[model samples]
Target: MINISLKLAILAAGESVSLFYKEQLEYFFGDAVAITAYSIENGSVFSPKNEDVYLVTTVSFECNEDILKYIPKDKHIIIGDVTFKNSTINRLKEFPINTKALLVNSSPKMASETITLLYKKGVNNIQFFPYYPNSMETYSDIDIAITPGETRYIPNQITNILDIQNRVLDRNTLIEIATTIGCDYLLDTKRFTTYFDEISNGGIGIETLIEKNSILRQQISTITKSEGIGVIEFDVNEKIQSCNNLALNLLDEDRSNLLFKVVQNIVLKEGVQSSKKTKNIFQTIYKNKKEEQINLLFIPIIKNDNVAYTYCLIRKNKDMKRENEIEKEYLKRGHYSRYTFSDIITEDTRLIKTKEMAKKMAKMNAAILITGESGTGKELFAHSIHNASERRELPFVALNCAALNESILESELFGYEEGAFTGAKKGGKIGLFEIAHNGTIFLDEIEGMSQTLQLKLLRVLQEKEIIRVGGDKLISIDVRVIAATNENILSLVKEKKFRIDLYYRLNALPINILPLRERIGDLEILINYFKKNLDLNFIFTEKAKKLMFQYNWPGNIRELKNCMEYFCCLNERIIETTMLPEYIKENIDLKEDKNQSTDFLLILEILNILKKSEKNEKGIGRSYILKCLKETNFEISEAIIRRLLQDMNKKGYIISTVGRGGSKITQLGKEMANNK
Candidate 1:
């Protein structure tokens, strides 16, 4: 006999047939396998200890990508018994043409894939409704209902209901078993005969198999010996057949008293009954003799369409306290931003319109992509939109994609199962997506996200779900995604750095914020707003104001706020032009020639020409500037004059609109011209 001891994790095994499949696999492998089953609905996964461990997924077609995220393709064993049968297609065909049907499955993704499959298989006449667990009441329009198991709800309009049973053990079981066990020739005559005999001729029951196999017993004992965990096994009649030492100690009952006792007489009796009825995993809290709450998980094991045995996994509630603390820490870090639309202090008409459009967009649930230069308040807009939306009461989680490396970013966004990697948390962590459920997730610097993560994010946006790292379960989330980027996302897509599909999905409601220099009209208002918030009594001199307006604010509002804070820290009642930051002064002076007097003359002459053009109701172009320079008896080249005009525009002496509109003199420009 092969000495291979396999630890198999079965994912999405909540269905009764899936449970039956699990029992069959266990029975066929006998004592050589230790199985841990998980339901995708529960959003929990069992972490395998080593690379030698195997993973099997009975999840629906849509969840294949999700399962693949956690398990390597080589390590994943595809059990053929988990799939639905062609009878489902035949049942759909029985319906009249143009019939409206509701396809109910474990998840929305599953239902969607099933509908697509039906259509591909020539059942296009029926309109299918993807299952929405929370919106079952709205399913009254459903004409027919098709489900993988018994229908949870039947609307009056649903005249026909079809329960499509998934095959428990397909003919490919031998091939699956051989592949799963790493055996090369289990299909050979001798090996196939032995395997067939073990499965067909009164296979050993799970309890008997464990009792007879000392190695299996030792493995179970070793696992159950972990501190703070309790395990118990019961027969099909709900009689406790075996209880680990941890369970005995935790329940405050010895084996003599607990063994052979009906499980309904013990703790979690109601949960056991519920799990048996539904054939689904259930959890409940049980109070021990010490009045301490214990978390109990009831999992039923099915065999030949009946419950063969059930396992009760128990742990002290206190064991979860640490995990809760970790979750709370992440929650604290994901607190909602207090900003609102009213907080965006701006007088610029274009910016006001943009804000209004954004407010309207917020009322809808589509994804929004905000594009702007850095520090242009893209995140501010994201916060304001979230606060104004219907989901304002929920969290506004913001993460900078560029701030972390790919590995850390993936873990923070999607989270991970326990032992997903080195130094992982004990019970795994809840990602920002889970934390921001029913709210908004602002992904700033989204262009910086890796291509791999972009594809994952695209799936989440499309499917409205996420699967944790090292976990096969799909967690549904209802979050409004607001992705922001300083770079041009379309350009990145063209460059093949970002996924084009994701770009289009996120760009459904695009909002572009103008840079500070383009919105100079808002500068004075922003300055006063920052000053009032800083509680500064200082007043800016006319020269100081002119100097600020003249310098191009490359850092936008964020830099302006910093400048205001620095001025307040100086404690000066009156702020002068010379008191500005050295860099600002240097930048201003750099625009002029080394000869300050000559530079001043050049600026004055250009302002004069622009002011004349304003009087003439005609903007001054480069050709006009050359003519004015020649008339002023200045021997400057056309290039020199053009450069001077550009410099004067940046200095706020002129406003140059795009196209053939040319440059026009501002009121500040007039003041400088008259003063000179």
Candidate 2:
């Protein structure tokens, strides 16, 4: 234990470097030490403070002796043990095999030492050229520069400078300080262990991954007797180090062929290529020789965010497969298309023509984007398109992007490694893309996907491969994507909420289905079909037919189906104008007092604004309207504005056009605003 509170000083080349180390030193020693910092860049190196101990930045640090000249003689000094932050080492590993980056530092020796530190941390992937101040080396061809918080020394040509945010002191320096300050007993505390763990593995905080290997073996032995899980341990080279009998059983491999062998799976390709690329725990699906589907969980024994050893746990898949109603013996997994082009019953030429276009598009392998309002049967069209395609015999997986949140949606769509993040699945799960390989994946409400996910999907479209959430292995897929969105995706792209390149990739074969209101010619046939499908012996009267024709189906086909269900529940054999649902009836009823309603009032205000802006080429947009409404303490959403504009256009009060034309107030709209 320290008899007195010790004072220490840190000297570095720059202010940022000095302050960073100063804070680190203070945090390391806590209240037991008083620390001061000085830097040559800030001209504070000669402040002339007598200190009990001096910590030079690094062993390779120049002027280490000169910096001490300002201090009192015979002071206990330690050259700091510096290392790259664990985060920097992980980032360095992400660079391609031949990626070149300039490693900038304060001095030539410091640069070389830092590069060595990176190599020691297992960041040997990138080719890092050392760059220090006034070094006559031109790295003009290199686009990226890496530095340990030394950004000012980076050359002007390098635009993408990744600052690893200052070199941090290694556990050795902390121990050296502890011993020097008579506080060596602090080494036994959890706080010190936590710091040590962070310096080792970026705060994941396990002293040795060898403990995990032992724990995994114990788990394999105990777990097989109970849970019947199969586990295999593999090294960075993808060579099998250990495998239990349960694993051999799952793999259907004989003992003579399994033990101490390089692993080669007939299915799932071991779910991972090289364990060296794997940094986090992930899972994939594979099948054994018996055709029994199994889940392979690649649990990485990580050190400093790099996989040292992978513990693969195999569990049986719960989904069963068998031949179904198809003539060919198809693997029935409930991921098959339920509709063909014949199922899309429509009398309208535009719809029939659109269906024909989609059917022709199905023959091709390019991506498809289906756009329509909610209840416009976009998903129905997607299913029909897939069934019409050659992949109809294969899986047709569908995912509603809007239904799940970002995390759940990501895992559901792309699949994830077990323990990818907090609350991740235990055994891990297969993604839809993996399940839909050699078939079609229908992403419903594609607009609802986050921009981050959009980029991933774009990559999948381009590369025809997917990386599971928290996984590194590229799983190749041959899938035809059919993405549907109820929202105007182009508007979202213009708003920067969606990626434009993703839009083009998906919109390769576009299908814009008309809403029920626009395609009313097919409404009667659809109505009767729905009634017959529900086994309802119902008929609508002439007055009811008029109301149905006049009233806009806001909920579209889904709302109409529910409306039919409502009538069926009412025990009505005949549905009249008075028997309609409130939502449908409200349109007719609300019209009488429409002038008094707040929505109508807002509509009137918008009409006046549009009337004024009618002379403009672009007219007026939702933003200007929102801005105007906000000025008057009115709260409104863009969706509500869109609905209002759509209703106004339908009523002939406004003429709305796509793109830059925006919406223009009609003569009727001017008269309506005058009424207000």
Q: In model 2, which range of ten residues has the least summed lDDT?
A: 202-211
Q: Estimate each model's TM-score.
A: 0.43, 0.41
Query: Which residue pairs show collisions in model 1?
Result: none
479-510: candidate 2 lDDT, tens digit per residue: 88999988887679658898755765676566
**Candidate achieving the largest lDDT:** 2
lDDT, candidate 1, 257-313, per-residue tens: 778888645455676677778876678887888888788877776544566666777
For model 1, state the Cα shift of residue 354 in Å: 0.8
Model 2 clashing-pair count = 2
* Collision count for each candidate, in order: 0, 2
